[model samples]
Target: MTSLFQFTGSELEAIKLSVGVAIYSSLISLPIALLLGYWLARKQFPGKAIIESLIHLPLVMPPVTTGYILLLVLGTRGFIGQWLYSTFGIKLAFTFEAAIIASVVVSFPLIVRSIRTAIEMVDPGLEDASRILGVGRLKTFFQITVPLAAPGIISGTILAFARSLGEFGATITFAGNIAGETQTLPLAVFAYMQVPGREIETLRLVVISVLISFVAMALSELYIRKMKRS
Candidate 1:
């Protein structure tokens, strides 16, 4: 089992990259998800249904399909991708950024859903009282709404981080599993599975991924419980 304790360079890199991507993806998606969730919870605008459906499409679609759509939009030769490349020399596909983007797309709907539910559950009268006291909407949001929705926000962020850590199909499809760059735990596990005598490495990565996901979920649940009790 000493061999199992010994981590290969690739394994360590994969762990680090996976964590970095998960963190970046969670941080990047939070503000947008917060605003979008508040909108979905509070607004009754025309075409909102269509917008929400589009936002949630990734959740229902096969991850590969989502990745393919991102590819079409962001690839070097793709539709708008060509314009981006011609204008800015920016090619997003098969890159570290692409992996984070993939994780964000796939995990966004879940975060939004959680936040929206939390916002909806909050009493509107509280917001109205804040408004009557001359608090601006933005201030009220940060001071009142956000504190009340802290449980959901924290849970949603944890869920996003966990989902990003375990992301595979979209990441692989868009980022191509390049080691020490776009490769994460799931990708590393996949790679190790393909190599002979790599069983230990694969097992270790799998255990790590599962443990991380479980801990994230547990933390979310515990925090929710504690908040409710208080």
Candidate 2:
């Protein structure tokens, strides 16, 4: 096995890109996840089931199918894609941006589910008490509710990050496997596997992927336990 520090330039680039994409995707999904989670936990609305099912479609559907849907909606000739390109000269397909978007879409359901469970675990009585004490609804959410749900939120973020890191099919289908541009760690592993005698390189990337995901889950659990104790 190659030393962890002995990654080739391509491997290093893939690692860096994977981290960057995961971070961006997780951060970008956070606020939206928070809102959706809170709403789902506390509100009753029309089409609620539909909204939830749609949000979770990627989880149930094949990843490649999800990628194909994304391509049809965001490709260069797509409705939104055409407008975006024509107006802002931005092309989302087959780019780093697309990879991030794919990650966000695939990982969003997990994030929402985690945060919603956390929010539901919080006592409604506490929020009502705060409101009765003249705290605005928004303020109550930010102060009492969010802090109480912090563990869940943190875990959800970590889960989303890990999911993003390991994303493969959607990323490859939508972003293509362009090294140093859109190819992330998972993509690198897939690429290495296609070539003979690249077993060491492939194994190295696989180990790195496993290590990253394991570390993320471990940290999340550790922090959650600490939070609970506190």
Best by TM-score: 2
As for candidate 2, its clashing pairs are none
The lDDT, on a scale of 0 to 1, for candidate 2 is 0.95
Q: Candidate 1, which segments miss by more than 4 Å at Cα? A: none
Worst ten-residue run, lDDT, model 1? 1-10
Candidate 2 structure, TM-score to reference: 0.97
Candidate 1 per-residue lDDT, tens place, 17-75, comes to 99999999999999999999999999898999999999999989999988998898899
Q: Write model 2 residue lDDT over 1-230, tens digit each, in one string.
A: 33645889999999999999999999999999999999999998999999999988899988888888899999989899988999999999999999999999999999999999999999999999999999999999999999999999999999999999999999999999999999999999999999999888998989889999999999999999999999
Q: Candidate 2: misplaced stretches above 4 Å?
A: 1-5
After TM-score superposition, the amount by which residue 100's alpha carbon in candidate 2 deviates from its true location, in angstroms, is 0.3
RMSD in Å for candidate 1, one decimal? 1.1
Cα deviation at 229, candidate 1, in Å, is 2.7
Judge candidate 1 at residue 129 and give its lDDT: 100
Local distance difference test, per candidate?
A: 0.92, 0.95
